[model samples]
Target: MTDRSDAHTATTPLAGRRVLVTGGTTGIGRAIAVLLASEGAKVFVCGRDAQHLDDALARIREVGEGDGITIDLAEEENVARLFEAATGYLGGLDIAVVNAARGAEGLTDMSEADLRYTIGSNFTAYLLSAQHAAKAMGAHGENATGQGDIVLIGSMSAYVLGKESTVYAGIKYGIQGFAIALRRELGKKGVRVSLVEPGLTGSDMVEGTSEEQAERIDKEEMLRAEDIAVGVHYLLTQPRRAVVQQVTISPRMQDEE
Candidate 1:
């Protein structure tokens, strides 16, 4: 639709919109769902874990209006099913948040399975989801303003180098390229594609870390999942005439390596 608000309430712009978020059962996706619903959106979320999906749905219901589905993005057929189900649930997809991601172990520990799983779950999923979202949003013709949005959640690791993050970085980097190319191709169709890159957010993905390491890394100073959700709302709320190509958010206190 249109984003008319300032920084104080960027999410207010998403009111009355229909949005679908992948991997929304926890972490950043869950935060995006909650914030979008609070802003008056009919949000739909998907995740592979049924229990997690149910929990996320309950939490969203408690806070606002939304639904959740269980589907593994790694499976192409499942990805298709998710879009179909989400379209029906949301009454038509107006916005898509591609947040599904999986981590790969260190480069030394990497195997064919790890590489395939990483790419399949992260990069490939976004490509497929964007393909589906573009079709669904384009099918709606144009809103009164003639536009829709597809936001891909990328990572700072996409461009950075970390000893153990090589494979994961590759996936995130691939997503960046995917979003940029997709945006160019879809611009004529009035479906804007954007990339949101958030750095170091607190989530279950890092739950395995020790408290000492967590402190050393200063998780407290890292970007919060809700913060990225705010960014997603901002990008989607922009007027049809405006497009935010990409946004990178990190904790002010975190140093770039």
Candidate 2:
């Protein structure tokens, strides 16, 4: 019989792996960073708020090892700097979670400035950051084999397409399409691309007091941010030969449109 014991295993271990999590100082992003750290991954995260960055890094350090910075990803130059800093800190990248985004109001209710910021931060940032992450992972380079992982954080807004969420839904729809194309573009180069869409998750993005959010979670009307984190973890920990192309996690009791 063949020496099957010496063969490579299907599961990708997280121990000592280098990870980059954008928008990781709050909500789903923060939860992902902490969970990866707990699993022995060396995490690097970024956020717009310095306080949140400190808090996240502290939590990660309490579990494993981590570092991070504060910067607004909407600016292209900042995105470049973020990758440079992240790779420098982690030595090299093995996984990247692109989760930085801002919620947008209704089109008619939004000011011109708000509209531009929403598009720039939510859509443009995701694109630019993913581009940099792919290059960092050596995608399209020779000798690539299971090079790395990229998980984009999308939203159920894409499918829901509810009123007052025009810009948000449009950006999420763009992300869904982008993930499909990106997986094909990078697959041959050994980079895996996946998307995780959360439905009605309780986070800073949602408008509610902590008590209200907790009540919603208790009622099963909304998902905890950690629920989305678990979905992200599932995508990252899969076997090398498989890629979970997309995962949509919705609250069981959430009324569907």
- Output the number of the TM-score-best candidate: 2
Q: Which RMSD values do the candidates have, in order?
A: 4.3, 2.9
Error at 47, model 2, angstroms: 0.7
Give lDDT tens digits, candidate 1, residues 1-257.
67655644423267778899999999899999988888788999998889999999998888778987888889869888998899898898889999988767877797888788878998778888888888888633343223578899999998777888888887788888888898888887788889999987877776445464357446556666888998887787766777899999988877778
lDDT of 1 at 3: 61
| Clashing residue pairs found in predicted model 1 | 3-237
**Each model's TM-score?**
0.87, 0.94
* TM-score between candidate 2 and the true structure: 0.94
The candidate that achieves the highest lDDT relative to the unseen native structure: 2
Model 2's C-alpha root-mean-square deviation from the true structure amounts to 2.9
Report the Cα lDDT for residue 85, model 2: 99
What is the lDDT for 168 in model 1?
88
Q: What's the C-alpha lDDT at position 89 in model 1?
A: 87
Clashes of 1: 1
Off by over 4 Å in 2: 1-9, 140-146
